[model samples]
Target: MREKNHVRNVNNRNEMEAVGDYYLNNKTLGKGEMKMEAAMKMRIADIGDEIVSNKGIKGKVEMVKENSVIIEILENLSDREYVNNRTVVSHKNYVII
Candidate 1:
C-alpha cells in the first residue's frame, strides 16, 4: 500500500511538471508585454455587435488561424459577430458575462 501511494504521488508530480513545461514553452510574453498573436484566440466579448453584450457571451478559443480563430461560446442563445483583427487589445479585459 505504501509503495502504491508513492507511485501515485510520483505520477501526479510528473503530470504537474509536464503541464508546467507546456505552459512555459507555449506562453508568448513576459510581464506587461502584448500577447503574441499566435497565443490569442478570437473572443466574442471583443466583438462590436450588441448581441454579444445582450447574451453575455464568453468564448474559449478552439483553434487559431491566419486571420481568425474557431471559438466555442457559452451563452444562452447563439449568433455570429464579426470582429476586426486589430481591435482585440482594446477589449481584452472586458467582462463577457
Candidate 2:
C-alpha cells in the first residue's frame, strides 16, 4: 500500500511539474486570476497600551506611524540591547499585552 501511494504521489508531482513548465514557457496568467491570499489585518496598538516585543521585552505604545509604532520599553527581561526612541516597530514585531 505504501509503495502504491508513493507511486501515485510521484505521478501527481510529475503532472504538476509539467503544468509548471508549460506555464513558465507561456507567460499568460489571466488578469485578476492571481489575487493575493488573505492576510492578517494589522491592528495598530493604541497609546498607553502595553506591548511585548518579539524579544520578550515589555513596552508601551507611544505613537502610531503609517505602518509602524513607537514603543517605549517599560520592562526588560534580559540585559539585551533595546531599540531607542526612533526605532520604528511594525505590527508583526510586537503584541499587545
Candidate 3:
C-alpha cells in the first residue's frame, strides 16, 4: 500500500497536542452516506502508541493532531536525506498496534 504520510512538512505541525480526542476528516470517513458519516464517533490515538502505516512502516505516536498523528518512523527504509524518521500520518492511513 502507498504510504499517504505528509513528511514533506514536518515542522508545520509542531503545535498539535500529544494526546486527546482525535477526529476523522472526509478522507478518513472514506466512501459512505453523508448522514452515517456524520453520526460516527471519532477514533483515539494517544502518544506512545505504536501504529503501522498503510505502507507497513511502524512508528511510535509522538503527537496527536486534529486528523493525523506525528510519528517517529520505526523503520529507516527511505534513503533520502529528508526522511527524518518522523512524519504526519493520517488517522486513516495507519492502524494502532
| Alpha-carbon TM-score of each model against the true structure | 0.23, 0.48, 0.50
Query: Model 2 off-target regions past 4 Å?
Result: 1-42, 83-87
Candidate ordering by TM-score (highest first): 3, 2, 1
Q: Which 10 successive residues of model 2 have the least lDDT summed?
A: 16-25
lDDT digits (tens) for residues 7-97 of candidate 3: 2222322111111122233223232432243235235579998765544456799999988999997764333243477888887766564
For model 1, the local distance difference test gives 0.28
lDDT of 1 by residue, 1-97 (tens): 1121111122221121111012123332222232232125325432333212112233444444544434455332213454522212124432222
lDDT of each: 0.28, 0.45, 0.53
Model 3 TM-score, all chains together = 0.50
Q: Where does candidate 1 stray beyond 4 Å?
A: 1-56, 76-97
What tens-digit string does per-residue lDDT give for candidate 2 at 1-97? 1121111122221121111111111332221221110013235689887755444456778898778788786665434665564345677655454
**Model 3 regions lying over 4 Å from their true place:** 1-42, 76-82
